[model samples]
Target: MNEQEKVKFFEEFNNGLHRLGRITLIAASLLLIAVPFMIGILNDVSPSGTGFLSGFAKVGIIYIPVAIVEFLVYAPMLGVGGSYLSFLTGNVTNMKIPCAMNARDIAETEVGTPENEIISTISVATSAIVTTLVIVVGVILLVPLQPVLQNEALLPAFNNVVPALFGALGLKYFAKSPKIACIPLLLMALLCIFVPAAINQTSLLLLPSGGLALAIGYVLFTKDKL
Candidate 1:
């Protein structure tokens, strides 16, 4: 189809997808809440109202900010359909983000385009399915794999999975735009070195790190330095 027709079609498609995503998310939320309530009702171990509220507040207060930040940081990169599917499936950073990025790169689609959105959606969906299958297989193999996995020689490798993944991904992006990436990379490294506690609260650190990068980019843009 022509550009106008294509854009119109994508808009309609995205609208429908958003409606379905919102409804399904609401249903999923209710079901999640209902399961605990139902079990408590059936088992006669219901938490006191005060205790429940207090506990919910404790966890919610910690996670709510992180969730909001994650959405703000990731949504632009993920786009409409990809965000819907990735958020629904979980594993946004470790699995879905990388999968979508790789798909867009391989397909040579610029971010925010319909083609990129479609590729990201498919990539995230496939990643989720593959992740689920891998989990299932891992569970099935746990008994056989236990000794191997628990080996002391491999322990360090297991512990550094996130760091290793990010290091590789970061290097690739750094190569792409070293000027933009260098600020955050150095800031994060210094934070990790001096503060140390920042490593444990990486999610919270996203705000400052991202803000710094954006501010630097803005300065560069205005000064014609980029």
Candidate 2:
């Protein structure tokens, strides 16, 4: 097809994707909200209006900002379909982002291009499917494997899983540009060391750390240091 035709096709594809994404997100949200109410109805018990509102407000205060930050930060990297899938499936940081980044790198696709978008979506979808299957198997095996999972010998490895995954994924990129990576890494490390609570607020820390990295990269680019 011609360039113009291809562009038109992509536009149409993205529009349809957005429409479906919105519909699914809305439906999923409604179902989530409805589940508790449905259970309350079945049990003939309901929370007080004030209690529900107060509880929701408390949780929302903590999570709402994180949700907005994640969407803003990850959407460009994940593209349309991937963002939708990742948000719906959860585990954006430890699973979807890694899968999408690995797929993009392996496919040699630049971000924001149609190729990257399709690859990201496919990778995220595959990750979601695999994660679902793993969860199902884990549930089935939970009783049988309880002793193994609860073993003190494996506790450290289980606790370090996320750090290990991110460390390995980040090492390659950090090696590529130690100059750009150093300041942000050092700043974050110091913050976590001095303010231990910051470690629990990973989503909030992403904003300043990411902004610092970008600013440093831009400066280095202008100075021809990158």
Candidate 3:
């Protein structure tokens, strides 16, 4: 009812929402990973489904119609209402949707303006151009011989390369930051290496990576003008 009460209430409410958001993100991430495997499984089982679709042309022929239908209907509605849903949910706009939503409305409604939109758009565009160039160059270079190695199946899997590459980069960035404390960061990095080694995949490394970063940060900051 009063100023302090409102502040406290809102702080608690925000904290609760943060916890819920974390849960939602965890679920969503798992679903995203699991869905690909599920689709793969379905393709394996159902001969009439995706498995039956031969070559790139066959896949494209089937995919285009369904995609066109989705784009014409469901996607437009989602694009329009997505901002409103973000506002209603009071979660940050992880991706942008051009909307009538204002700043105050968004602030009280959503957390932050969408950074993901810009970052993802730029990243995808750059990757597409670079990859296309690389593939063309590779095709030219490898045209003479070794046709078998040029096949998709023979090419190394780069899907899981992103995590290791980014992890190394992230550690480098944090290590260079003004973190005087080494214990936490060291421990976490070690854990990141070991946890995935010991247990299953999917964010087991985060426990260590996060802990180390926190420890480094704390040791560097809390020690003060010694």
Candidates sorted by TM-score, descending order?
Answer: 2, 1, 3
* lDDT, candidate 2, 105-167, per-residue tens: 999998677889999999999999998999999899888888998999999999999999989
Clash pairs, candidate 2, are none
Q: Which 10 consecutive residues of model 3 have the lowest summed lDDT?
A: 91-100
Best by TM-score: 2
Tens-place lDDT per residue, model 1, 34-54, is 998899899988869997786
TM agreement with the true structure for every prediction = 0.61, 0.63, 0.29
Error of 1 at 131 (Å): 1.5
Name model 2 segments beyond 4 Å from true: 143-226
Report RMSD for candidate 3: 16.1
Rank order by lDDT, top first?
2, 1, 3
Off by over 4 Å in 3: 1-154, 157-160, 163-185, 188-202, 215-226
In model 2, the Cα lDDT at residue 213 comes to: 85
